[model samples]
Target: MNSDEIKTGEERPTRNKWNLILGILFLAYGSYRLYQKLQIPDDDNFGMILAVGFIFFGIYDLWKYYKGV
Candidate 1:
């Protein structure tokens, strides 16, 4: 293959690694927020929603990683 035709298949793994890392971070943060929400009484307004949103986003990232997207 010519130099110009040489393709490095490294981007996918790098991208996936980043996605996985970010996904885990988001998931952890979400879980922590959820725990905090449970610990705090009479504050069941937006914290739960935010936690769920973050968890969903993390799951999406994992899905994307699996799909190689």
Candidate 2:
């Protein structure tokens, strides 16, 4: 209750914004990688896997943001 004391975590306002931000970033990066994969012929599929993974996580983050969890 002291004037100089900082607010506790529970007393602070919630700002759950990183989820949306990371979601957008991840989606963009995934889409770009996917496009590159489609444009190029490669012997390795690892890049494709990574691209899909990014897309999946992106969607999950977006979902979390919307669900307010």
Candidate 3:
């Protein structure tokens, strides 16, 4: 394809709405995991860590959306 066509076909990251939806989903999943961890009788250190990581990633996505980066 020509350069102009290629440039036109390329999507700007900030224009993608799925990023925001995915971020919200990640946040929700993290919260759900945390709740599950709390309900478990045994120690859930791994679950807690994973939940924290998910939450952080979600927040970072949100930040990126806001910053348009």
C-alpha lDDT values of all predictions: 0.82, 0.86, 0.80
Q: Is candidate 1 or candidate 2 better by lDDT?
A: 2
lDDT of 3: 0.80
**Model 1: CA > 4 A from native:** 1-15
- Residue-level lDDT tens digits of model 1 in 4-60: 788877555434687888888888999898888888896687879999899899988
Stretches of candidate 2 off by over 4 Å are: 1-15
Candidate 2 local lDDT, 1-69, one digit each (tens): 786597556554344699999999999999999999989888659999999999999998988887777
Each candidate's TM vs. the true structure? 0.71, 0.76, 0.71
- Candidate number achieving the greatest TM-score relative to the actual structure: 2
Give the Cα RMSD of candidate 1.
Answer: 4.3
Per model, state how many residue pairs clash. 0, 0, 0
lDDT, candidate 1, equals 0.82
Please tell me which predicted candidate would have the highest lDDT against the true structure: 2
How many clashes show up in model 1? 0
